[model samples]
Target: MPRIDRRSFLTSGLAAAAIWRPLGSARAENFRTDPFSLGVGSGSPKADSVVLWTRLILDDASAATSADPFAPVPKQVAGPIDVEWMVAEDEAFSKPVRSGLYRAVPEFAHSLHVEVKGLQPGRWYFYRFRSGNAQSPIGRTRTAPEGVDGFRFAFASCQQYEQGFYSAYGDMAKKDLDLVVHLGDYIYERTYGAGLVRRHGAGVPSMLYEFRDRYALYKSDPELQAAHAAFPWLAAWDDHEVTNNYATDRAPDAPNPAEFLARRRAAYQAWFEHMPVHPDLAAGFDALRIFGHHRFGSLLGLTLLDTRQYRSPQLETSASDDRPERTMLGPAQEEWLARTLGASQAKWNIIAQQTLLSERDTRAGPATGYNLDGWDGYRAARSRLLDAVQISKAANPIVIGGDLHAFYAADVKRDFSDEKAAPIATEFVGGSITSDSPSEASLAAALAENPHLRFASDKHGYAIMRLNDRSAEVDFIGVADRKQRNSPASVFQSFAVSDGIAGVNRL
Candidate 1:
């Protein structure tokens, strides 16, 4: 038997190709084991293509064993597994549009990333994976529409499995959405807090096995799986996906930079293995380019930003901490964003990012304070992005984010402190899917101090955005209780951002 590292296994190309011979006649008998335990997902949809994903989970010992426990361990499969996939026009898979076979190898956790193409735009399709006799759950996906008038999407974040159930996803799954935007915090790295509805099963993920296992545990949830199967997802990562409040190559509490980078590498690999993202986004261990734009005809343009991986280290902020050198989106990404916003001719330009872009002062005095981890810490960068929006004349620029675990509807003004400066955009910070929130009293106080914030709610839920040529209506949906499974969710508040308006109006 030969041993190979994960990177080599993935990048070897032709070297590993010889090992992927067809499974042949004995395929059904060999693949009797259920390999689709992690479920299936599709993402990065364009007008003609989408990526389909599924990992072959061939029993716990074969897939989960690790010698270092915290390091990337090679998976041991019986052999190169043959995966079959199909895209159809209906749930029954009667009208087949595309079908193909992919070789799932152990180097990449036996996961298949099939980039299917030649599909029509603005159309619904059903997809599924098959390995021998075993079949995966069917997932529904859509391609970006060209020249469409409207589309609906739901944005969610901060789903800490232990804190509560994924009931919000259940409700989201029921909605008719063109896509689902997961802003960040898909999984928490460490476990804390009391009253955990479910445990992460293992300790904080520092190595490849731990990180992979953690993602597997979260993906095993029925509700989360349902949401993934419901629609194609556009995802970005915040701190928790790697570690709490991690910025770029640095982890604040880590004693050494080398150790933190190693952990980050492991987390990035696991995230890539599980997500239905495009293979082009994979940039080895150091980083993954998760920021890109998705166009829905001429109606909407969604630019997903990666704020965590390309930011300066967290800073302690005071009234005078705003500096030009401090950055959230690194120079290249910043340039890319500015160019993208400038070029977008859509009716609405949406910045789907990870943290609250608006300033939120937590202190009791007139002295201004800001969260060191959010955009408030990178004041100059936020200003530059906002200025780009204004200079580009981007139509109906709306920034949607999730991180604070509280819902916030605010006007992104040219200057948050200056009442004279007209608003440049609108921002809606969705509440967490299941994570806990601060006290309502504290949220109220913050809201009162920040008049730019039109509404604030410390609850557990997600947001539904209905976009059209005229306006974008956002319903801030809140779950009754995250601790309870099947907890009902309702619109806690609704706001509309009309075309050409840079402010949110409560409805």
Candidate 2:
């Protein structure tokens, strides 16, 4: 094998070069067509390791495209099969740094999650999986760096399959980015909307196989596959991953606790099967906690939260649920966050979670209203996080979230009722990938009622951030049109937050 330059692996052609590759002449098994059509992905980056993932298309059960996303999906079980995977210093697989054989099993839908470790920190690596003569797409991933002068990443969420196309992800695939953070609502459980560009059929997922079929339908998209293959991602779930408006063991329509828990269990199992999280995460399906912290050297600390799993039930009015005992992060997650914040010495601290963090008054005129489904319903819980930041003196705290189907920029205040209070941190909520947003009339009223919310948009897209030692710059990349596939996207707005600033300023 010849020496390969490490930098050459990260050039502009990174995504294109690996876009097409014939199967190697190693024929261990034969298939009628490409079995790697669903594509490959990686996540959970560490200093010496990162997780690589791929699901084999062993049968034609999930290959057919139906008119509805929820139409009954075919199912078959066959796995405990051998899969060969390698992480190379170059895209050519010439300088193999780590390689192994992973056993794909039926328990996890034949999905492979290999946490390859002992890797060089902050370096780009190419990976792929092979079964017999079939080769998966070449995916690019990187281990967390020990240090950095600058870095760029994007955060997005809420891609409703039937609502629109995945052009946002397609646009992201062409950009240079180290990480991608998906802030939940990966798959909508039910179909409910108007003027939808597509259809999810006429059903909602509930059972394990139903959920698996739903995932197969979404993952089959080529644009989504390309984005997954381009960069490492940190993903979490929200209400839709299970059902609409479901809280910790509670659902508005689910009158029976036992039945609800069973549905949630299946949802959790399916989420674990489809996501590229740690293998051990599967152990906590019943406990309803799926959150963790990651670091990119001294530059940044990221805490991915699970707001839907262990949270209090929904509140219709913000003031109705401000009880001192109402919790959002739950006690354990809150404790972990506090401890993590206290110990973090990074210049930038980020809370990547779901929904809006700052208060959003949905009413107009001299009246106070709040979206209790958010921080408003659990003011005390929000206070706990803020208190932890203040007590720990966490540096440059910033919060980015989704689920609102709109973009929002706000300064989270120590006290929202008091306009004179100082902001404790800055918050940015990126637009939904394809989900619909509130009416223009609703957004206008929201802006008028809440002066703290600097900006909000109903357009669909993602948010890109470039961070350096001195500041973090963000751009709202909006899709020009989502009613059609292959639509164009561009940055319509930009904002910046200086190192010591506690608020976002329009750039």
Per-residue alpha-carbon lDDT of candidate 2 for residues 1-507, written as tens digits (9 for 90 to 100): 122111112223344335423334433445435667678889998989999988876664543454568754543336366777888888777777887777787888888889898999998999987665466768888888898888788999999999999999999988888899999999999886888888776488778889888888889888888888888999999999989888898998689988989889998988888888888776766764568898998898999998988888887655563677889988899999999999999999998999888887798877777777788787889888889888988899999999999998988887877777777898999999999888878888888788788888899999998889999889999999888899999999999989987887998
Candidate 1, pairs of clashing residues: 70-207, 147-297
lDDT of each: 0.83, 0.83
TM-score of each: 0.91, 0.91
Sequence-dependent TM-score of model 2:
0.91
